[model samples]
Target: MLKIVYPICCGIDVHKNFVVATIATTDRENITTYRTKRFSTFTKDLRALALWLSNNQCVHICIESTGKYWIPIHNILEPSCQITLAHPKYVKAIRGKKTDKKDSIWIADLHKHGLVPGSFIPPADIREIRDLLRYRSKLVSFASSEKNRVQNSLTVSNIMLSSVVSDTFGKSALAILSHLLKHPDDQDFDFRPLLHGSMLKKQNDIALAIDGTINDIQAVKITLCLSHMDDIKRSYVARGTAF
Candidate 1:
C-alpha cells in the first residue's frame, strides 16, 4: 500500500464560476474520510473556503491548474495553505465518469498519499514583472501591425517613400509624409525643405517618390494608422516607466 503523506489534506477543482473542494482525513486505522463542498468563485466564497480549510486543519492543499481559474483561489489561500499546483493531466478524473466532486475527491486522495507533483510558480513580484513584459510585447506587436498598415496604405496610394528611405518612419520621412498628406492635390510643391542630412542628397528621388497622388480614403486610413501607432508608443512608454 502507498504510504500516507499528508494524513489530512484538501484538493480543489477550480472552474471559472465555481469550485469543488474535498478534504480527506485519515485515521490511525488507515481508513480515510472525505468531506466535499462546493463554493462559488467570488472572493467572499473563496475566503469562506479558506476559513473552512483552516478549521479542518488541512494546511496541505492540492489543486489542478485549469487555465487561469485557479489563480483567485490560490491568491485567497496562499497565506494559510501550502498549495500544490498540479497539471490537469497529473490528476485528471476517469473519462466518461468525470464530475467536479469526483475530480476533487480524486485529487484529495492522490495528495493524501503525496502522489501529486506541484508545478513551479514564481514569486509574486516576479510574476508581476512577467505580466508587465508580456503586455509590453503585445503592445509592440500591435504597433508593428499598425506600421505595416501605414506602409500598405502608402503603397496602394502609389507613394514610394519606402523605396527611397531606410526607415519610412524616420524623422525626415515623416516630415515629407506629413507635407504630402497635407497637400494631397499639389504634387509640384518643393520637398527640399523637408529633407535632412543625407536625405538632401536624395532630393530628386524623394521628389519622384512623393509625386504619387493620395485619395481621400487612403489619406484617412494612413492618418488613423499613424494616430494609433502614436497612442501605442505613448502607452508603451508609460508602462515602461511604471515597471
Candidate 2:
C-alpha cells in the first residue's frame, strides 16, 4: 500500500502561453527534476501533456488557478490523472525576485512535503453550468454596451431623451428615437406612445427630448451591434446544441 498511496508527483506553473512542469520521484532517497519542456492549453497540446506526464509516471499534479485560464488545462488532465487546483491568492510565494522556472520548482518542492492545499473542483456537469453562466454574463454585457452606445449617440446630437424619460429605451423613447434615426428631420419626433403611461403627464418634456439628428454612420453601427446582441441571446438559449 505504500507504493499505492505515495507515487510520483508533478507541479505546474501555468501562464497564458506556456506551462512549466517539474517531476519528482517519491522514493525516500532518489529525487529527480525535469523542467525544460513547455505545454499549451489547447486540446491537442493537453493530450500530449497528459501522455508525457503518464510516461514520466506522475500520479498526481498541482497547479495554481489564474482566473479562467487554468480551467481548460485542469479539465483536460483531471479525467485521466489526479489534479489539485491550487488557489493563487491562497498559495502566494515570497514577495521577491522570481522567474517562471523557479516558481514551478518551488511548487514541486511544496507538494513533496504535502504542504499545498487545493480548492474545490466541481463535477463535470456543474462545470458545464458554470461555463454557460459565464457566457451568458458576456452576452448581458454586450447588450448593455450597445444600449449605452445608442444613448451616447443621442446625447452627441443634442437629444436629451435620457433626461426626460426614466428609460431612454422605453416605449415612448424608442418610438421617437427610432423615428429620428430613420429620418433626421425634427418633425419626425412623433410622441404617439405618450398616449399611454409612457407619457406619465410629461408629454412636453418627452417631445422636447426627441429632437436631435445623429450621424448616419454612427446610427448604422449601433443598429448592427443591437442586431448582434439579439443573435447572442438566441444562441445562449440554445446552448446544449453542438456549434
Candidate 3:
C-alpha cells in the first residue's frame, strides 16, 4: 500500500565474488518494470554496473551492507547516484524462499516505495581517523601482552625484580637482570657497577632481590622475553614517529 516515491531506482545484493543488481522503473500508467543483472565484483565489472544503472536513468540506489563487499560498489557508484546504504539486519528478506536475485528485487521494491531506511555513512576523513585509532589500539594491546609475558617469566622463576623495582624494564633494572642472566651461578657477583644514584641507595635490597633462584631454563625464557620486549618497544617508538 506504499506510494512509489522513486520511479527509477536500483538495489544491489553484494557478495565477495559477484553482485546481483535489480533496477526498477515505473511508467506513467504506474506499471513497474524490473531489469535484473549479474556482475562480477571486480573494478571493471563494477564500472559496467554503474554504466548500466546510468543508462537506465537510475538515480537512487539501495545496497545492503554485506560485510565489506558493498564498499567498493558504493565507492564506484557514489559520484553518479544517491546511495542508500541499508543495514543487512533491516533489509534482510524472510528466510524460506530467499535467493540473491530475490534479495536484490526485494530491496528494490522497498526502496522504490520509500520503505527502506538508510544507515549512517561517515565521511572518508572520519573513516580514516577511525581506522587509524583502531590500529593503534591493537598495537597497544599487543605491547601490553608482551609486557605481561615478561612479568610472568620473571614471576615463575621466583625472581623478585618486580617487587624491588617500580619499573623492571628501566635501565638499572635491565642492567642488573642482564648481569644476573649472564652469571646466574656466580653467587659472589657484585651489584656496584649496575647500581646508580637513587638505585645505588637500594643496593642491599637490589642484591637481595637478584639473589632469587634462577635455573638455566628460567634464564633462557627470561632472555627471550627481554628480546621480545625490546622488539615491542622499538615497534611502539616507530609507530609514534609515523604520526
Candidate 4:
C-alpha cells in the first residue's frame, strides 16, 4: 500500500479593500505564501475566491471576524470547504510591524499551527434574522429623532402641545397638526378637543398655546417630520412582512 497526503489548509486575512491568502501543504510541512489580491466587497469576488481555493486543493479556511465584515465571506466559502472564523479581539498582533498583508499571514501561520481560537458562529438563518432586527431598531431610532424635532419646532413656535399631550402623534394632536400643515395659520384649530381630565381646566392656557405665532416655516417642517414618521412606520410594516 502507498501513503497519500490530502489537500492544503488556508488562512485568509480580510481588509476593507483586499485579502491575503496563505496555504500550508501537508506533504512539505511548509507554508506557501501567495500574492495579495484586491477585491471589492461583492459576491463576484467571494465566488472567485471559492474557485481559487478549490483550484489550490485547500480544504480548510481560517479568517478573523473583524466585524460583521466576516459574515459575507464566511457564508460564501462555507459550503465549498471547512471554515473557522477567528475573533480579532482575541488575536492580537505580535510586538512588531502590522499591516493587512502581514496580519493575514500571521493569522494564517497561527491557524496552520493550530494555535488560533475560533469564535462562535451562529447558524445562517439566525444571523440573517438578527441583521434584520438591528436594521428595524435603527429605523425606529430615526423615527424617534424626528418626533423630537417636531416637538422642538412646536416649542419654538410657542405651541405648548407637549405640556398637555403625552405624544405629539396622538389622535387629536396629529389631526390638529395635519390641519395646521395645510393651513399654517388655521385659527379654527379646535383647542377644546386636545384637553384631557384637568387639562380641560387649562382651556385658557391651551387656547393661549395655540394662539401663539404659528410660523409658516416651522409648520411646514413639523408636517414634513411627521410625514417621515409615517414613512418609517410603513417600512416597519414591510419588515414584518419580509419575516
lDDT of 4 by residue, 1-243 (tens): 222223366767777666666665545534355544445558888888888788888867888887667777888888888888887765667878787777766665667666667777778888888888888888889999999999899888777877766766777667666666677666766756754565567676556656556587887788789889999988777767763
Ten consecutive residues with minimal summed lDDT in candidate 3?
A: 234-243
lDDT, model 4, position 6: 30
lDDT of 1 at 106: 95
What C-alpha lDDT, on a 0 to 100 scale, does residue 32 get in candidate 4?
52
Quote model 2's TM-score: 0.71
Question: What's model 3's lDDT at 101?
Answer: 91
Query: What's the lDDT for residue 52 in model 3?
Result: 98
In the order shown, the candidates' Cα RMSDs to the true structure are 1.3, 4.7, 2.5, 4.7
What C-alpha lDDT, on a 0 to 100 scale, does residue 179 get in candidate 3?
81
**Residue 83 in candidate 4, Cα distance off native in Å:** 1.9
lDDT of 3: 0.86
| lDDT of each candidate versus the true structure | 0.91, 0.73, 0.86, 0.72
Q: Candidate 2: give the clashing pairs.
A: none
For model 3, residues 1-243, the per-residue Cα lDDT tens digits are 568999999889999999999999988777888999999999999999999998999989999999889999988998899999999887889788899899999899989989889998888788878888888788678767777876787787677878878898888998877887888877668878877668878877877777676788877877887787677678778877553
Flag the better candidate by TM-score, 1 or 3. Answer: 1
TM-score pick, better of 2 and 3: 3
Best by lDDT: 1
Pairwise lDDT winner, candidates 2 and 3: 3
Q: After aligning candidate 3 to the native by TM-score, how far in Å is the CA of 10 from where it should be?
A: 1.4
Q: By lDDT, highest first, what's the ranking?
A: 1, 3, 2, 4
